[model samples]
Target: MDGGRDSEIAMGAYQPGYLATRNRAARGQVHGFRVALWQEHLGRDAAAEAAGDLLQPSSLACVRRMNQVAEKHWAMFADDSFRGDLPGHLMAYPVGVGSGGELLNTRDKFPDTNAKVLGTKSNILPPILTT
Candidate 1:
């Protein structure tokens, strides 16, 4: 698949793949996702590594290593994603008619919604800035 990029594209990689991208489109009018890293699932050595990696001066290596820890916790708590133990109903939403409502539970559905909310001219900031 052409160095796996084609697969990523096929799987909707061209979309707003990060929270920052979505927030930028909304002109900073967005509250970003809250990521609580639950380290109980990490073993002693891995936990130590994560702590050291996270505490180090911000760098690509530190960020990358911590991201691996986040990924592990996310996989374990996909339904909650570190929002604490919420009831099932709190995590569920009704599917809109014929709108692939089944996908609302997925991370890929926000781009279209963001476009509708922020792409409109009505949502634009005025060209002139005043104190």
Candidate 2:
């Protein structure tokens, strides 16, 4: 018998292995985005002003990098070579005094990488609030 049947008998649950794998892939994508964001923002050693221009916290480039990471995760998920699903976990951010401020999601915040890779505009906003 396949492992799926054994798992079901042992846990008294019917696990959707395919769906679980897909979810894992999705998580991987999100993780990639986090890494890309960090690299784009903190990977440089330039002056503050120059870095500001290149790595705007809310620029499209930054967002694109995040999306690219997600895409890679998706690819890995679709690949049959990976038997298990990707792990589900949240991407953590460093907290500081000035770090918790809200970022304005404007068109400028969309990364150019979206157009280059995904071939369309990416709706990557985490939901907006007006106060």
Candidate 3:
């Protein structure tokens, strides 16, 4: 659901209610989710950097909240089907570029998001690459 870009970009790809980024309050939540993971797993400062965000960028507080939520979910999922068996705070990522979070065991091991060196910001789009 959240594999592609932001609000309008995400909405265009699916029917309504398909994903959390479906509404305005859910706006910036994708960044918040990533912030949560990075803050908990790495640290707050690192999370901010990966997000290209600042400590008081207005939504940074929301970022912290999302991190707390994910951490809490990990704790409360004692035997839940989604993430009970995972070793630590890490969430499961999808397999390859377009797998769309297939499943825990079915997909490949989650990649380290920290290691992703994304393409530079550009007005003209970069050359596309396929997996």
Task: Compose the digit string of candidate 2's lDDT tens values, residues 42-72.
Answer: 3333123233333343568655554444445
Q: Order the candidates by TM-score, highest first.
A: 1, 2, 3
Which regions in candidate 1 have their CA more than 4 angstroms from the true location?
1-45, 79-131
lDDT of 3 at 103: 29
lDDT of 1 by residue, 2-65 (tens): 3433222222222244333422332121212111122333444555665645433245866676
Model 2 regions lying over 4 Å from their true place: 1-55, 84-131
Q: Write model 3 residue lDDT over 8-93, tens digit each, in one string.
A: 12222233442443333333555455446556654454455545443233466656744554454444443334633433343323
Q: Model 1 residue 60 lDDT?
A: 83
Residue 38, model 1: lDDT of 22
Q: Who wins the lDDT comparison?
A: 3
TM-scores for the candidates: 0.27, 0.25, 0.22
